[model samples]
Target: MEKVLSKKRLQIPQVVAALKHRNFRLFWGGQCISLIGTWMQNVAQSWLVLELTRSAFWLGVVSTFQFLPMTLFSLYAGTLIDRFPKKKMLIFTQAGLMTLAFILAVDTWMHTVKLWHVLILAVLLGVMNTFDMPARQAFMIELVGEADLMNAIVLNSSIFNAARVVGPSVSGLVIAKLGIALCFLINAVSFLPVITGIWLIRLPKPVQPASRRCQEGIWQGIKAGLDFVRKTPGIFVPLALLAVINVFAFNFNVLVPLYAKNVFHAGAKTYGFLMGANGFGAIIGSVILAIRSAHGPKMRSLFIAAAGVSIFELLLVPAKSYTLAYLLLGITGLWVITFTTNCNSLLQVQSPPNMRGRVMSIYTLVFGGLVPLGSFLSGSMAHAWGAPAALGLGALISLAFTVALVIWRPSLLKQEISFKWQD
Candidate 1:
């Protein structure tokens, strides 16, 4: 175990090799721009939905709409990734996303936007993301080659967290002045960098198979992904942890508006500030991971991070006052980013290039798709128990999940979670 773990550790620095490549920079830059915008829209969309509906139930519902498609659509998207140029696919998705954002802005600006309109846009966005996410996940290799894949993943997290910091702060300011419509418009603009990045970067051809293999369709890919997960508990365990934790504790996004409106008595700007503060913690967490001295692929770091998520979630539940809740949530966001980023890093590390897209699609499905159902349960439970009790219960569930991971995956605890080709 130690020898295998040691070998895996050494692979960590190999991903840093991406910085040496110029094309990778273009791709990274574009991703950073788009991600920031995506975060901006995220903050804006949640609040807007809350404002329009003023119902926490629907907030969970809208969140569900966005992710449910990924659960349903990701397998097919992964299959398509095997069939198409990832870069071109991303371009189409990005363009579709930007156009949708613009249409939302136009609708809102014209005072024609309704709750149903938002739901429609949200669902369409999910469709765009289903294709965009897996392709983007796979395309990172073309930018930097495989040696620096780990670094690219880490750096991507850094950019994402950095955007989390920037997007909400700016979006909050914009929302205070302009409203959610303008925030959507800004999000549309963010897509430009990614589009440009696609236009500029040189990509390597995918290792072609002699023949296409498709014994089934979306369910087939989904079953394949689940089968992969079942065989690799190192991967599936964390995924189950994510799903269980999210069902109880991850409703913070759904709850944020309540925290702001009912608890804090604040408006759009305050909501943005709350999100931005959380982003600060996320930024700090990502930077720590990016610069962690742990040599090799230190994915055991994720187990630690998952533990942090469990702890911080408990912190948020009994928060006596609104300020206390805000602080706990900000810290929770930090831990949240830490765990997910590490999970992604580990998933990418252990997966083979041939099955990478499908594996990651499964990862995405577990991470995001499962969450909507979780949110619904959390919201319903909260609706019954009151907010704090619901949140506390959720936190406890997450903690239990992390504890199970530590017990079941002793290999992960040792930071030895890799599967190499036995040549």
Candidate 2:
């Protein structure tokens, strides 16, 4: 009994091995604070757009504008991230985002803000994030080596979702009591922690290739990354699924706000709570992944999580009661996190050290790039058929795609991912 208890005690540290690394801890703490503010701005932005336009189509337009740059620039951004020091690059990107947030805040505070202003700022933010997302994703390896890579990724997801929970809840209160501008202002201020953290981070310099790749030009690097993905089934299959998910089923920003207002006749607080419910479920899923971080990927589990998300989302379409809809959304959140975390951890673990940045940029692109397209379609559907129809249709498409993939390539589902790409 004593031996068994000792083993159990020893397992605790293994679950949180990434936290032991000083650099990761600093980055994680600062990013946690900043991401909370980011989520606040996300809720506020959607609400602001909804208030101003009263058109689901316009709401989709705003989302499309904001994320378009990510699709266009992410491939190039990946090359730049690989060529530079990710730490310093992130500092610059964070500062740029902070500036954009401040401008939005001030404009709204002065009562001079317009829809066009928000749209243009969204474009700028998207451009900045094109650079930021890949750098941040790739930088994780430098903080904690391969042995703890999955743990670190899972922890990062937990932090992101934790912010998702707090940010939306707080933003709802602030929007109700204060104003929308304050949310952006608070988000602007929130960047200070992450910027300061980046400045203070100390790590051994990354080893450079004997000959720098940039000297030959970035296109070569981009081509190599593309080739790697095309040739590798392990990465290709998951990435293909991610793109489908993004295009058909990842329009939560557009769907949730519309549902709150149209279906429930609820205010910002209710919408915020619904968003918070999703985050809370995500937190639960993240914790589970963190605890089981050491385990290898289960092909069956991955497909099930994907299918689970679509099923719950479809069920939410017919849910008439607030409680039922909220519960379904939470379940959707849980499975979405599980599916996403699995994709991210698998990609990171599989890629070679030199290609990690470019690989992750592809990851970011698929994850975020297709969002604009999804948002636009979802909004159009909502405008014509209602929010429930839009969400249900998207979810159905995702489910169909998952089923088709499994049937077309059963080996893709059965093969165990060894977490390393073969050269």
Candidate 3:
């Protein structure tokens, strides 16, 4: 009995090996709390927009403004991330985000919230995220190093999805009972823990950029990052696949709300429940990745996950019942996280230390930066043909793109390179 107990204790760390590191544990815990608030705000904000405009196109517009900064300035942000301390950059960005949430909360509470107000706040939030996303991604290496990097990334996804599950469900309850303003207020308060966590984190001094690299202009630094990506096929292919998937298929912020409200004649509670179902499946996928972290990423896994996302999305097109739609979305959520986590791990592993920030910035650019375009496309389509048709069309484009990508680069599916990190 004692031996079995000891064995179980020993096995526990392997499941969450990244938590053994002090810095990552601190940041992860804080983020775990904070992201739930972020998700709450996401659900509330979408429902709020739908309420104000009664138009899906406006919802897309809000999403477009929110991510446009990433599209416009992510390359510059990447160069800045490489040049400066990511931790400090993150602190500033998080503070900015908290402030925006507060402002929105106040406006909503006062009953003066306008569509223009939401749009403006969203653009400011996007500006903060432009810096935050890449810096945060690149910072993971410093937290746990390459030995546990995959675990750290997967664990991060796990918390994010976990928050997705909790936040939206709670937001529905909060929005129904208290008000939408309270969701934004809670999100504003949630940033405190993460900011404190960042402040407390200690790290070995990061390698400063070379004098020559630092001396170069921002545009030159951006050009160099682009050139590196262009030369590296391993980094390039996953990003290309991500771009297609993100642009066509990642319009859930627009599609899900419209589907819940317009198609089902439902309310905030229904929207939250659907989003929560998706988040639940994503958590399951994250657990799978966490268990397989020791093996690192596989190209085959990446491609298969991408196909699964499109296939599940295609299934969603035919889902006429809420239960059917919910089930399909849950499966879609699983594939979405798996595909993205693999792409992220693959990119980080393939990038050199000096170029890591720039590489991940490009990753952020494709994964998130292009979402504005996708939002607009999906929103416009949803407005015209309905949410199901918009979703089906995007899935079809993504599926076709995935197929062509494989045919053009057969080596990608066959290749599964492994790496040993040298401190």
The prediction achieving the highest TM-score against the true structure is 2
Show the colliding residue pairs in model 1. 9-296, 10-296, 15-148, 15-151, 248-394
Candidate 2: which stretches are off by over 4 Å? 209-211, 421-423
Candidate 1: where are CA atoms >4 Å away? 1-17, 209-223, 320-323, 408-411, 418-423
Query: Which is superior by TM-score, 2 or 3?
Result: 2
Q: Tens-digit lDDT track for model 3 on 328-411? A: 999999999999999999899888877888999999889889999999999999999999999999999999999898898888
Cα error of candidate 2 at position 409, Å? 1.5
Residue 93 CA error for candidate 2 (Å)?
0.4
Q: Which of 2 and 3 is the better model by lDDT?
A: 3
For model 2, name the residue pairs that clash: none
Least well predicted 10-residue stretch by lDDT in candidate 2: 414-423
Instruction: Give all TM-scores, in the order shown.
Output: 0.89, 0.97, 0.96
How many pairs of residues collide in each model?
5, 0, 0
For candidate 1, lDDT tens digit of each residue in 76-157?
Answer: 7787775667778888998999999999889988988899998999889988888888788877766765556666777887
